[model samples]
Target chain A: MTDTTQAAPASTRDRLLDTAAELFYRDGIGVGVEVLCRAAGVSKRSMYQLFGSKDEVVAASLERRLPASEAFLLPPADDDRPPRARILHVFERLEVMTAEADFRGCPFVAAAVEVKSPEHPASLVARRAKNALTAFFQGEAERGGARDAALLARQLTVVFDGCGARAVVQAQPLDGLAVVTAAALLDGAGMRS
Target chain B: MTDTTQAAPASTRDRLLDTAAELFYRDGIGVGVEVLCRAAGVSKRSMYQLFGSKDEVVAASLERRLPASEAFLLPPADDDRPPRARILHVFERLEVMTAEADFRGCPFVAAAVEVKSPEHPASLVARRAKNALTAFFQGEAERGGARDAALLARQLTVVFDGCGARAVVQAQPLDGLAVVTAAALLDGAGMRS
Candidate 1:
């Protein structure tokens, strides 16, 4: 549907990245460059020209997903929800995501895990993505006067990632488990309203 | 080294399973059969004879690891520690494990996520492994007289898993974060030693 004639390079880049994200998420990071290019409908020559290596594609795909991923999990910018609710909002979204049949796990975490090399480019991107969530939590914790904002943020991130793993391994709905766990942590930290 | 002279079939099976567990854990599930057989000193035909397929190898490798994995993570059989201590012991071991250079999160979790299929033989093995951990937690929770033993056990499993994820993504030592978070949840649930 894209007007390939206008800004063709950018359009091609977008197409490749979109495909990469989906393929990698569904099929682990082991997906080869040949398969990736064929699936994206982009020629191997063009893909190589746009990205230096398949690793670059992996990193870029995850990087491109960061904004939308945060948007989906985090509350709206203008919404003045309480810090507790804002924090809980992430888990509520995650619970719904886990209910979907195709939900594998957090793509970022998956990339990091599959790569097995923490120093890999995709792992770095995944780390930043996870850190961004932790930072968001820390900011809210500070605003809400949590006893240890940094620790609370880290704890919340752990719960979020843990819930994702549980959903994948169990292949079962979390029901209200994620929300309840997050709320318990919020309460334990005395983060009321 | 396995003595191939005695009970060669069983020895071959042991060698293949051990190598498969290490290779699959270090590398992702995408390691080709050729590479796996080469590393294990196994012939492709021999591997097929021992296990019906690569999927079976993955499942059996994980199955072979269950006892050692549980022993590594859980308290000793004769451990007379109270319920709370028994539960926390798992996190302690996890923190230690995460500090290793080659730690790639929980093998079961990594397998389940990498496969992206809940019904895959390996994924089933992963689910059973994770459930065993949860069952261990549940038993301890009940013994501790927690208000909601099932929920507490679930929460504890989440914390344990999340801690693994945090360590993997950040590539940093937990430094007691897992223990603290687990303890906080225990306190919140009124699970006293």
Candidate 2:
């Protein structure tokens, strides 16, 4: 309570959300309000003013990462690659992400699993994020003329998540496992280039 | 420290680990030492005496669950099913487990993700547990005559984990996604019955 709140509301909000996302990903979701505020360099009062509670902050922060997550994981808007390549591109990116020393699997999955309560706001955001990935996969599957786009999409998503989990549990990069698994799914679905 | 260490040491350890598994699975690994001890009805002093640290408790609890985890997830002993059936049986079990209201994904995967530090004792135990699953898959793949047993085993593991992640994020049962994906992979690998 003693700390002064000098930063403007907008900047303060951005800073808090950024810090929240980073800390929550690095550590577990159990990080306390004091620790989060301290890491963000924001006062407790300012955090409360912007976010109703830490749970809201967790949800909002995950929401904020969605656009960037899709942008990077999904193919570029102007890219001319076929549906199959476009879909495989996502897994390729995942393989690269997993190679990083700090990689800890999909943040969305991590958050939802750690939150435990599926009804929690953060878990809701996580579900939405996961669904978006599935939607992307389904769209690609359809464009590629797969026999059953919906099933193919779900299959691809399962592979995506499974690869992420493997990386985390094995504490090793996927190398090309992501790409190979996705390719197998695409092949099985008869999703042509 | 005030609470007396009343129970015998062996029973006390069992009670503590059992409670730890239940609470940690229901909640997350972040459950504090005091809360865990209180739930187990063991004094803090007694818990410390038995387990060197909370981390050890987490690891040992997970280690204790391994036998049952394998027994349930793996095909039953003395079953005469073929390799494909044995492999699909695991996913069938996973589908059933995910249907439970209390399902929270694989405890080992959850623990590894929550711990963040791969070197953590709990993470190591989780890795060992996951590896056992992969080994079982590998054995079945070899028996079934997979084109490449190692790769097929890895793919199956990825699908298993991906389905688990899907269940946790969606907060809904997989509804056969697990079995279908594993079957697809088995087909792609050309693993004969």
Candidate 3:
């Protein structure tokens, strides 16, 4: 429980964002601003003051989540695990993520589909989430000494995103399957399997 | 354009299904029934009489599409191509599918995400679509003489779906990469690559 007195504007804003993120990720973006205000205990006036619009709230929520998602997909900093293993470790985190009761698929993929306009704020946030994963994969692939880091990164990201979709659509844990497939992918690419 | 005056009930019904499927697939299910009715040039009364609800319309659209989707993924009957090749042929079709300007990844995948409720009518439709793909893969795997046809089918499906998600998120083709990974998956499983 946060101290109400110490709760600043940032705290109020975070409460709103946290609620919005949960609703948006758990359910689709079909959720509305009125419902969002009700869920967050914030008035509509303050909601708009803080976040501008529902789209901004959506984008902000995704932006807030980007680092956490990146971290979960990232193995660790200063850890000497081989690059291929680090790359595969993303699935390990994925398994843990999908194991949660509230597990939903990739929020970015959902947002990308829901916010149809390519230049929409939420769309850009979703794109950032996706590109972050790709860049992470590229860093690890380069560390693992892949001859073509970009190609490897793109392929791994596909398997990663695919696993997310399968997990949600099938409503089951597919990270193990993804991990196995990723290994085969590494081996096929002449990386350490 | 459909001829409204001469349209029989069956033709009117098909017009709704055809237009709804086109709209639902091209855009997300965000397109409402009013828009669907408008596009199909049908009355809401007739639409309700034929399909029941928007959910039903979405489900029916997907159901109406099953045979055609199956046809594209299915290897040619009496296809003289190697079983492994038949198995990999799905990606070949996938490339063509994604190449369409209006392609929005897998409709079933989109439906699975967009429909929200797993027990929803459209949800079930999406599941059926996925299962059909799996069944197709299993058949090809068996025909290819795989030691474990089901295993190859599952693995290949992962890569197949991964490619689909990747293609949409990146707005680029990863079917080529998926084809390569599918080959490796087959090879690793002791199936012919």
lDDT of 3 by residue, B54-117 (tens): 8999999888988888888778788888878887788888878777666677878888888876
Q: Which stretches of candidate 1 lie over 4 Å from their true place?
A: A1-6, B1-6
lDDT for each residue of candidate 2 in A29-88, tens digit (9 for 90 to 100): 899999999999999998998889889999999999899989989999998899999999
Q: DockQ, per-model, please?
A: 0.89, 0.83, 0.55
Q: Which 10-residue window in model 2 chain A sums to the lowest lDDT?
A: A1-10
Show model 3 residue runs off by greater than 4 Å.
A1-7, B1-7
Scored against the true structure, residue B48 in model 3 reaches a CA lDDT of 92
| Cα lDDT tens digits for candidate 3, A1-193 | 4666667778889999999999988777878888988999988998989876888999999899988888777877976888888887897888777777666678887777766555679878877788888898888777777767787777777777777777767877774777877777777667882
True contacts kept of 3: 0.50
**Strongest candidate by DockQ:** 1
The Cα RMSD across the true interface for model 2 is: 0.6
Predicted candidate 2 versus true structure: per-residue lDDT over B1-193, tens digit per residue:
3235544677889999999999999999999999999999999999999989999999999999999989998988898899999999999999999999999999999999999999999999999998889999999999999999999999999999999999999999999999988998899899858
Q: Is candidate 1 or candidate 3 better by lDDT?
A: 1
